[model samples]
Target chain A: MKLSILKNELNEAIQNVSRAISSRTTIPILTGIKVDVTFQGVTLTASDTDISIQSFIPIEDDRQTIVQVERPGSVVLPAKFFVEIIKKLPSQHIEIEMQDQFQTLLRAGSAEIQMVGLDPEEYPVLPSIEEEQVFSVNGDLLKTMIKQTVFAISTNETTPILTGVLWNLQDGELKFVATDRHRLASRAAHIEVDTELRFHNIVISGKTMNELSKIIPDQNTMVDIVVADNQVLFKIDHVLFYSRILDGTYPDTSRIIPNQYKTELVLDTKKLTEAIDRAYLLSREEKTNIVRLQTKEDGTIEISSSSTELGRVTEQLEVKQFNGEALRIAFNSKYMLDVLKVIECEHIFLGFTGAMSPIIFKSTENVNSLHLILPYRTTT
Target chain B: MKLSILKNELNEAIQNVSRAISSRTTIPILTGIKVDVTFQGVTLTASDTDISIQSFIPIEDDRQTIVQVERPGSVVLPAKFFVEIIKKLPSQHIEIEMQDQFQTLLRAGSAEIQMVGLDPEEYPVLPSIEEEQVFSVNGDLLKTMIKQTVFAISTNETTPILTGVLWNLQDGELKFVATDRHRLASRAAHIEVDTELRFHNIVISGKTMNELSKIIPDQNTMVDIVVADNQVLFKIDHVLFYSRILDGTYPDTSRIIPNQYKTELVLDTKKLTEAIDRAYLLSREEKTNIVRLQTKEDGTIEISSSSTELGRVTEQLEVKQFNGEALRIAFNSKYMLDVLKVIECEHIFLGFTGAMSPIIFKSTENVNSLHLILPYRTTT
Candidate 1:
C-alpha cells in the first residue's frame, strides 16, 4: 500500500500487531502482515489461524498527523523483516509506496529499501465477531482479572478445554476461572451490561489471554469484548485482538469449593510468600514440591521442607490470627507461592477443611477472588 | 564456623565468586563454593578448574562490622543454591553456624535453612603465582581495554590460541589483542612496569576476560595483574580472580594490519554506523553479510546490500573528508558495526588499501586502539 507515515507511530503499531504472528506458521502468507491503506487510516493485521491482531493508525489526530494516504491499496509484507526495518529506519518520516508487481519501496531520510510484497488476497481474513453479546470493562481491571486466573490454566494438550480460562457472566458480575485439577484460581469484577449481554461457558486459551493482557493499557481506559459463535474479539483503542474459543465444555468447579472451614489463618501476604518460596527451593530439589505447615500451641506456624541430599529448612512466623484446632497440613509450595503472588493485599486469609481437602486463600481486604489448592497427603 | 553478617555484604561476596562456578563442570566439589572463616574475615571462593575467584569480607571494615568470626572453620556449600538463598534471605542480619558433621544452619529473621555441606578438604586449591612479573593498571581502563578487544576473539575452539586475547607487555606499554582471522582488534595503554616484567605472549581466554571485565570496578582503583608460567591473577582490593593461560604461541597479526592506505575517508562514527547497520539487515538475510561502499566523485559514499529473495537496501552518507584514490570496496557490515560500537569518538577515520585488502578503523581522538576488518571479494 502507498502511504507516508511517521516511523515511530508505525513502529509501535507494527509491534502490537506482531504479537499474533507465529514463527512456526504452516501457511506462507500467514507469516506476513496484511497492510491496507484507505482514506481514513492505514491498518496492519497479523494472524496465525488461531488468533488475529490488527492495529490502525489514523491519518490525522487533534495534535498532529500520524499517517497520510497516497493511494488506497493493500499488500502483505513479511512481518519478521518489516518489523525490524521499521524499528531501525533512520528517520522520523517514512514513505512507503507500492509499485509494479507488488514491489514495495520504503524510503526514510537517505535510505531506500525495496521488498517484494505478497498479494493481500492470500492473507487470511479476520473472523467477523458480530454477536450482540458484548460487554465493556476497564482495561486495567481486565488485565488484572486475566493475570489472576490465567496462570492456573492447564497447559496439557490432552485436556484441550482445560488449557483455557473459563469466562462466566451473570447479572453485572464477570468471572474468570482456571483449574489444572490440583489448583484453581478465580477472579471476578463488576461491569455494566445489558440484561441480554450475558455469556457463559466461553473459554479462551491462556496464551491468548496473556497476549491480550500485554496489549491492554494499565490506565483507566475502557475495553470492549465481543463474543461470536467460535471467536471472541477484544477491542482496545485502535487495536483489535481476536482469538478462537475452545470447543469442549468446561468442567463444573463450583461444588469443589467448600463454604465452611475447620481451620483459618490470617497472615501477612509478603511474609508468607517469602517463607513458602524459601521452602520451595528445598522441595524443588526433592521433586515432590511438598512443604509441611503445622500450627503450634504458642500461636505460631512452622513451615518446613527437606530433601535427602540438601537437608531441611524450617521457618516460623507468628501470623496475625490463627484459630480452630491445631492444624498440620502438607501442600505444594509452588501452588501456594503462585496464589500469594497475584494477591496485592497486605494480609490474606487461608482456610482448610482438613489435610486432604482443598485449601482456600482470599485477600483479607477483598472478597471478589479466591484460590484453591488441594493439599498433598503425606504418609507421615 | 559461626558468624553474623549483613545480607547485602554476603550476597555481593557470593555473587562475585559464583562466576567461577561452571554449570557443566564434571567435578562434584567444583560446583560448590568454599567458605572459610577466620579471625581476620570470611573468604568465599569458587573454582571451575580453569578459573578461580575469591572474595574476602573482613571482620570489620572502617565504620561497619562486616563479619563476626565466632569460630574458625571452612566448609564447601553448593554455590548455585547459596547465591540464590542469600539474595532472597528475609532479614538484614544473617547468622550462619556450621555444626558437627558439616551441617550448615542459616538463620535470618524468623527463617532458618539447614543444608548439607561438602568437606572443604576436597576443594581445589587456587594457583599461587610467584613470578615477580606484576604490574598495576587502572581498573576502569582495564575494563575498557578488555571490552574493546575481547569481542574480536575467535569463538572457534579449533584455533585454541586465537580463542584467547594475546597480552603483550613491553617498554611500559600494555597491549591486548584479539582476532578471529577475519578481523582483529587491538587496545594499548601505558603503565609503569619494571623492565624485567616484559612478557611477549600471555594469552587468556575471552570467556575469562569477560568475567574479569564484569568484576572490575568502574572507579580508578589500581588492579594488580600478576603473570606466572601458566596462570594469571588479577587482584582488586580483597578480591582475587585467577585464570589459566592458553598454552600456545599466538599468531603474528602485525603483517595483516596495513601500514599504508590507498583510500582515506573521515566520517561521523554514529551516522556511518547507523547507515551500515541498516544495510546489514538485508545483507544478513542474504547470508553473505556483504555490503558495498563506493566513494562518489563528490565527497559522499553509497552503502548498499541486496538479497536474491528479499530485495535490497541503499544508503548514502556524506563524509567529512575523502582523499586519496577513488575506491569501491565490499566488506562485512556486521564487522564494521561491531567496530563502530566500541569506538568512543564522534568521528572516526577509515583507511582502505584496496578493494580486497583490510580496512582499518580508529577513533579520531585516540590512536591507542584500532580495528581491522578484511574486505569481502565481490564480482562487481
Candidate 2:
C-alpha cells in the first residue's frame, strides 16, 4: 500500500476496528489488523473469531481530502504497535508504503518507522450474510434499549443461552428481554417494518451488544441490522460489526409476569434511589443485601436495613399515590438500585402482588419499559 | 457530640484525613477515623502507625457558620463507611448526635443512620513534635519540587533508605535528591530561614511524599515545616500532617555527577520528548529500552531503536546549538523520557562527558534543577 493519509482520520478508524482485536487469540494472524487501500478509500479490519469489526475511510469527507492514494495494495500490521504509533505520530499527514517482502514503511513528519507486515491472504475472511432480513432503527433509541436490558443477562457459562439477550419482533413492535432468574429487564420500541416480516428466539451475547453500542453514533442516525441463519451484521455509518448467534433456545418468560397488582405506589425516583442506596451500604456488609419496606396508614413508606456489626439505616419516604392494601416486603437493595438508575423519569410506579411475588417497576411517563425483581422472603 | 455541620465542609475534611487510613494495618482501631468535637471546632484524624493526618473545621470561618456545636464529645468510627456515607448524604446540613453506649446518630434530610462507634481512648495518639526547628515554603513550590524528584526513588525494600528522598537544608537553601543507582534527579529552592540552621541525612518515604503532595493546595500559600529528631510535621491552612523519618544514612551521589562536559547540545523540549517517546515504543518490546543517539557532522542528531522481531524507528532532529566534539551514546529511553516529562521549560540543554559516562539534562531557563542518567554500554 502506497498512500498518504490524514493522521486524525486514520487514527480514528484504527481505534474503531481495534475493539475486536483480542490479545488472547490463539491464531497468530488474528492479532494483526488487515488494511486494504484502493482508489475509492482505505479499509481497516480486525477479528477475534467471535466478532469482527471493519471501518472504512473515504478519499474525501465533505470536500476535505482525507487520503491520497499512489498505489493500491493490502497488508496486515501488528495491532499493538500500529495502534500506539498512529496515535502518537507528530504530524497531521502520514505516508505509508509497502516495500519488498511485505516490509511496510510509515513516515510522519521527521519520524520514520519500518515494520514486517504479514501477508493479507493469511488473515481469516469475515462471514458474509445475505441482507434479506434487515431492519433499521434510530441510533439513540437502539443504544437506550441495549443499556436498559443488557445488564440483567446471566453471567454464568453453565447455561450458555442465558448469557445473551432475547430479541423478538411481531407486527411493527420490536422487543428485547434479558434475565438471570433473579431479576429481568424488558424494553420495547415501535419500528417501521413489514407486518409479515417477523422473527423470534434470536439471541445475541450481552458483550457483543455493549461493543455495538459504543460504535453507534449518539445523535439521531439510522442503523441497519441484518439477521442471518447463524450470524448477524450491524451497519453503523462507515463501520460494520458482525457476531455469531447463540445456539440454544431462550427460556419462556411471559408467564412469570403477574397480570394484576394487589398494591401499587407512585413515588419520586430520586428519593427512593437515595433511600435504597443508604440502606444498601449496611445490608451489603451483612452479605444479604435485604432491605425492608412497609406501608403505613399515614400514606408513607419506611425503608430500613440493619447489620449485626454495623447499626441501622431508616428513612420515611412519602408516596404520591397509594392504592390497595398496606403491605411489608423485603427485597435486594442492590437490585432495586440498579433498576432505579436506568429510570430517567422523575416518578416511578411500583406494583406488588404479595410479599413472595415479583415486584414490577415502570417509569411513570414511559409505558414501553418495565423491570421485575423477586422479593426476598425474610422470617422477620 | 451534638452538632449541625455543613455537608461540603465536613466531607472535604473527611477525604483529606482518609488518605492516612490503611486497610492492611495490623491494628484494628487504626482502621477507624477519630472525630473530636468541642465548642472551639471539630477535628478529624486518621493514622496508619506510620503517618497521621488531622483536619480541623472551626465553628465559623470568615463570618460564615460551618459548624453549630451544642455539646462536646469524641468518637471513633469506621473510616470505610463514614467516608462514603458523608459524600452521598441527601442534605447540605447534617445533624450528628451521640446516643448511649457510644452509638452515633446522623440525620440528613429524611434519612437517619445509626453506627456503632469504637472507644476514642483505644485509638493511638499522634506524636507530639517540638516546633523548635521550623521553616516555611510556598505550597505550590513545594509541590513542584516533590514532583520533579520523587519518581527516581528506589522501590526495592532491600535498601530501606533509598526508598526515601534525601533532604538537605543549609544556609536557607533547601534541596531534595532521589536516585535508584541508575538515574538521579535533584531540585533546590531558597527559602527565608535561619542561616545557621543546617540539617542533613533526613529521608522521607516516596509514598508519604506522594500522599502529602495530593493534600497540598495548588495555590501559593505558606506551609510551615517542623523537623524533629525522628519525626516531621507539615502544617497547611487547617490541616496537620505527621510523618516518621526513615532510619539510615543516605549514600553520597555527588561523585556520580560530572563537573565537566565534552559535548553539549540544546534542543526544543517538546520535539525531543516526542522523538524519544516514539523510539521507546519499539525498544520497550525488546525488553532493553535502549535508544541510540549520535551527533552528525552536518549539525543534526539521529535517534533510533530497533527490535529483532519488530523493525526499527529512526528520526533525525535539528538542534538549536551543538558544541564540543561529535559523540554517539546509548541509554535507556524510558529513563530519558521520565526526565523530559518533568521539565517545564521550552528548551533543554544536554551535557555528555563520553559515550559511556553519565548524560546530564537541565532546563535552559532554570539553574537550580538538573537530571542525570547513566548510559548503557552496548556493542554495535
Candidate 3:
C-alpha cells in the first residue's frame, strides 16, 4: 500500500484496532494488524479469535484530506511495534509504501522506518456479518447500560455462561442483566424498534463489552448492532467491532429481585456513598466486607462495620424519606459501593424485604435501572 | 491523643509520614504510625527501619487554627487503615480522643471510628542526631539534584553501596553522584556553608532519596540537612526526614568521564530526546536497546536502531554545531534518553572520545551537571 495519511487520524485508528490484538494468540499472524488501502479509504483490522476490531479512515473527512492514495494494497504488520512507532512518529503526515517481499516503508518527517510485514493472506478473514437482525441504540445510552450491568457478571470461568451479560429485547424495550449469584444488576431502555423483534438468550462476554465500551463515541450518535446466532457486530461510526456470543443458557435473574419491600428508605446518594465507603475500609481488613445497615424510627439509618483487629466504624445518616418497618441487614459493602456509584442520581431508593431477602437499589429519578444484592447472614 | 485538628493539615502530615511505613517490615509495631499530641500541637511519625519521617502540626499556623489540644497523650494507629480513613473523613475539623486501653476514637462530621491502637512505648524511638556537620540547601534544588542522579543507582543489592547515591560535600560545594557501572550521573551545587565542614564518604539509599523527594516542598524554601555518624536528617519545613547512611566506601566515578573528546556535537536537547526516543522503541523490541549514532561532516547526525525480526528505524537530525572527527558510536538508547530528560536545558553538548569509549552529555547552559554513558562495542 502506498499512501500519505494524516498522522493523527491513522494513530487514532491504530489504537482502536489494537484493542483487539492479543499476544497470547497461538496464530502468529493474529498478533499483527492487517492494513488495506483502497481508492475509498484505508482500513486497519486486528483480532484475537474472540474479538475483531476494524477501523477505517476515509480519503476525505469534513473537507479535510485525511488520506491520499497512490496505489491500493494489503499487508499485515506486527501490532506491538507498529502501534508504538505510529504514536511516536514525528510528522503531521506519514507516507506508507509497500516494498518488495512484503516489506513496508513508513516515512514521517526525517524518520524512516522499514517494518517487516507478513502476507495479508495468512491472516484470518473476518466473518462477513449480515444485517438481517439489526437494531440501533444511542452510543451514550448503550455505554451507560453496559456500565450499569457488566460489573455484576461473574468472573469465574467454570460457569462460562455467567461470565457474560444477558441481552434481552421485547416489545421495543431492550434490557441487560448480569449476575454473579451473589449480586445482580439490570437495566432497561425503551427504544424505537420493531415490536415483533425479540431475543432473550443472547449473552456477550463482560470482558468484550468493556473493550467495546472504550471505542464507543462519547457523543449521542446512534450505533447499529447486528446480532447473529453466534456473533454480534457493532457498527460504531467508522469502526466495526465483532464479538463472539458465549454459548450456554443464562439463568433467569428476574425471580431473584424482590417485588415488594417491607422497609424502604430514600437517601442522598453522595452522603450514603461516603458513609459506606468509610465503613468499607474497616470491613475490608476482615476480608468479609460485611457492613450492617439498620433503619431507625427517627428517619435516620445506621451503617457500621467492625474488624476483630481494627475495631469499628459507625455512621448515622439521615434519610430523605423513610417508610415501612425498621430493619437491620448485613451485606457486602464492596458490592453496595459498586451499585451506588452507578446510580447517577441525586437520591437512591433502598428497599429491603427482610434481613435475609435480597435488597434492591433503584434510582429515585430513573425507574429503568435496578440493582440487587443478597444479604449476608450473620448472628448478631 | 485528645485534640481537634484541621483535617487537611492532618491528612497532609499522614500522607508524608506514611511513605516511610512499609508493610514488608517484620516488626509489627513499625507498621503503625505513632501520634503524639501535646499543647504545642500533634506529631505523626512512621518508620520502616531504613527511613523514618516525622511531621508536626502546630496549634496554629499563620492566622489559621490548625489544632486545638484537649488533652496530651500518645498512641500508635495502623498506618494503612488510618491513612485511608483520614483521607475520606467527612469533616473539615476532626476530633481525635484516646479511650481506655489504647483505643482511639476519631469523630468527623457524623462518622465515628474507634480504632484499636498499639502502645506507643512499643514503637522504636527515632535516633537523636548531634548535628556535628550541618548544611542547608534550597528544597527545590535538593529535589532536582536527587532526581538528576538517583536514576543511575544500581538496583542490584549484591553491591549494596551502589544502590545508594554518593553524597560528597567539600569547600561549600555539595555534589551527588550515582552509577550502575554502565552510566554515571553527577550534579553539584554551590551552597553557603562552612568551608571546613566536609563529608565525602556518605551514601544514602536511592529508595530513601526518592522518599525524601516526595516530602520536599515545591516552594524555594531552605532545608537544613544534618549529617551524623550513621544518620542523615533533613528538616523540610515541619517535616523531619531521617535516612540511615549506607555503610561502605563509594567508588570514585571521576575517572570514567571522558576528559577529552575526539568528536563533539551540540544540538537541541528536546530534538535529540525525541530522535532517541523513537529509536529506543525499536531497540527495546530487541531487548538490547542498542542504537547507533554517526556524526556527518555536514553538521548533521544519524540515529538508528534495528531488530532482526522487526526491521529498522533511522532518523537524520541537523546539529547546531559539529566540530570533530566523523565517527560512529553505539549505545543503549534507554540510557541516552534518561540523561537527556534530566538535562533541563535548551541545548546539550555531546562529547565522545571514540566509538567504544565513554560518551559524555552535559547541558550547554549549566556547568554543574554532567552525565556519561559507556558506549556499546558493536561490530557492523
Candidate 4:
C-alpha cells in the first residue's frame, strides 16, 4: 500500500483512533493501529476489546487535499512509536509505502523511516453493528448530556451494570440516567425520532460514553447513533465509534423521586456551590466527606462539617426563598459538588422529602436536567 | 497568631512556600507550613530538609492593606489541606485567629473553619546565615543559567555531588557546570560584584535550583545570593529560599574540552534540531538511543538510526560549513535534544575531535553557554 497524506490530517486521525489503544491490553496486536489504504480513502482502526474506533481520511476534502492513495493494502503498525514519530516529523507532507513482508516506510521532509508492521488480520474486525435502531443528535446537546450524567455512574465495578448510563426513549423524548447507589443524575432532551421507535434499558459504560464525547466535534455537527442487539455505533463525520452494551436490566428508580417535597430552598447556584466547597475542606479531612445542611428560622441555610483530627467548618447562606418545614440533613459533599458543576444556571431549586429521603436539585435555567443525592444518616 | 489578611495575598504566599513541602518526607512536621504572625506581618515557611522556602506577606502595599496583625503567635498547619482550604474560601478578606491548643479559626465571609495545627516548636528551625559572602544577580539571568545546565545533572543518587550544579566564581565571572558523566553542560556569566571576592566551588542540589527558579518572579527582580559554610540562601524581597549544599567536590571538567577539533560542522540550529529529533524517533525504539552522524560526500550531514524490531530512519541535513576530514560519530540523541531545547540560537557550532571523543555544541547567539556530549561506541 502506498499513500501520501497531509501531516495534519494523518495526525488528527491517529489521535482519534489512539483513544482505544492501550498498552495494558492483553492482546499484543491490540497495541498496534491498523492502517488500510483503499480506492476511496485511508482508514485507521484501533481497539481494546471493550471499544473500537475507526477514523477515515478521505482522498479529497473541501478545505484541502487530505490524502492521495496509489495502492490498496493493510498493515498494523506499533502505536507506541508511530504516534510519537508522526508528531515530531519535520515535513507538512508525509508519504507512507508498504513494502515486501509488511514493512512500512514513512518519509517526511529529509527523514525516512521503515517500521516493522504486524499482520492486520491478527487484529479483531469492527463490531458488526447493523444500524437497525439509529438516531441522530446534535453534538452540543449530546456532549452536555454525557457531562451531566456520566459522573454519577458507579466507579465501583462490583455492580457492572450500574457502571453504565442507562438510555431510555419514549414519546419522542430521550433520557439518560446514571446512579452509583448514593446519587442519581438524569438528563432529558426532546429529539426527533421515528414515532413508533422506543428503546428501554440501553445501558452504555461510562468509559465508552466519555470516549465518544471526546471524539464528537463540539460544534453543530450531527452525531448518528446506531444500535443493533448488543452493540452500539456512533458516527461523527468520518469517524465511527463502537462499543458493547452492558448485559443487565436497569433497576426501577421512578418511585424513589418524590412528586411532593416537604421542604424547598431556592438559592444562587454559585453561592451554594462555594459554601459547600468550604465545608468540604473540613469533611475531606475526616475522610468521610460528610457535611450537614440545616434550614434556619430566618429562612437561611446552614452548612457545616467537623472532623476529629481536623476541626470544623460552619457557613450560613441566605436563600432567595424557603418554605415548608425547616429541616437538617447530612450528605456527601462530593456528590453535591459534582452536581453543582454540571448545572449552568444562576439559581437552583433544592427539594427535600425528609432527613432520610433523597434531596433533589433542579436548575432554574435548564429544566431538562436534575440531580438527586441520598442523605447519609448522622449518629449525632 | 491573629491576623486579617487579604485573601489573595495569603493564597499567593502559601503557594510560594508550598513548593518546599513534600508528601514523601519522613518528618511529619516537614509536611506542614509554619505560619508566624508578628507585629510587622505574616510569614509562611515550608521545609523538606533538603530545601526550605519562606515567603512574607507585608502589612501594607501600594495596592491594598495586605496584612493586619493584631496578636503575635505561630502555628504549623498541614500544608496539603491548608493550601486547598485557602484557595476555596468565599470571601475577599480573611481573618485567622489561633485559639487554645493551636486550634486555628479561619473566617472568610459567612464561612468559618477550625483546623488542627501542629505545635510550631516541633517544626525544624530555619538555618541562620550571616551573609558572609553575598552577591546579587538579575533574576532573569539566574533563571536562564539554571535552565541551560540543570538538566545535565545526574539523576542517579550514588554520586551525590553529581546531582548538584557546581558554582565556581573567579576573575569577576560566575560559572555553573553540571555533568552526569555521559554528558556535561557549562554556563558562565560576568557580573558586577566585590572586586576581591571569589569562591572556588559551591555545589547546590539541582532539585533546589529548580524550585528556586519557580519562586523567583519572572520579572527583572534582583535576587541576592548569600553563601554560608553549608547553606545557600536566596533572597527575593522578603522571600528567603534556603538549601543545604551537597557534600564532596565537583570534578574539574575543563581539561576534557578540547581546543582543537578534527572535524568542525556548522549547521542551522533549528534545522539540525528537527532532523535529530526525527532520527531520535527510531533510536528510541531500539532503547540504545544511538543515532549516527556522518559527513556525506556532498558536504551534507547524514543522520540515521535502525532497530531490529522496528525498521530504520535516515535523513540528510544541509550543513552551513563542514571542514577537516570526513568523520562519523554516534551519540545519545536524548542528550542532544536536551541541549537543543535550552539553546536560544539560530545556528550552532559542532566541534568533533574523533568518533569516540566528546562532541561539543556552542550556540552562535550566546557564547556563555556550552554543552558537551560523550559519543557512544558501536562494534561496526
- For every model in order, the TM-score on chain A comes to 0.98, 0.98, 0.98, 0.98
Superposed model 4: Cα runs more than 4 Å off:
none
Question: Candidate order by DockQ, highest to lowest?
Answer: 3, 2, 1, 4
How would you encode candidate 2's per-residue C-alpha lDDT over B1-82 as one tens digit per residue? 8999999999999999999999899898888999999999999999997789999999999979999999999999878889
The docking category that best describes candidate 4 is: medium
Instruction: Classify candidate 2 by CAPRI docking class.
Output: medium
Q: Candidate 1 at B154: error in angstroms?
A: 1.1
Q: TM-score, each model?
A: 0.98, 0.98, 0.99, 0.96
How much is the lDDT of residue B302 in candidate 1? Answer: 94
- Reference-based TM-score, model 3: 0.99
What digit string (tens of lDDT, one per residue) describes model 1 on residues B125-222?
78878957888999988988998999999989999999999999988999999999999999999888875679989999999999999898777889
Q: Comparing candidate 3 with candidate 4, which one achieves the higher DockQ?
A: 3
What fnat does each of the candidate structures reach?
0.76, 0.83, 0.93, 0.91
* Per-residue lDDT over B1-380 for candidate 4, one digit per residue giving the tens place of the 0 to 100 score: 89899988899999999999888998888878999999888989999998999999989988788888899999998788899989998888999999999999999998888888999998888999997899999999999999999999999999999999999888789999999999999999998898687887799999999999999998899999998999999999789999999999899999999999999988998898888887788888788889999999988989888889778889999999887989999999999999999988888999999999999999887889889999999867
* Candidate 1 off by > 4 Å: none
List the candidate 2 regions with Cα displacement exceeding 4 Å: none
lDDT of 1 at A53: 95
Alpha-carbon lDDT of model 2: 0.93
lDDT by residue for model 1 over A181-211, one digit each (tens)?
Answer: 9999999987888856678999999999999
Task: Give each candidate's interface RMSD in Å.
Answer: 1.1, 1.3, 0.8, 1.6
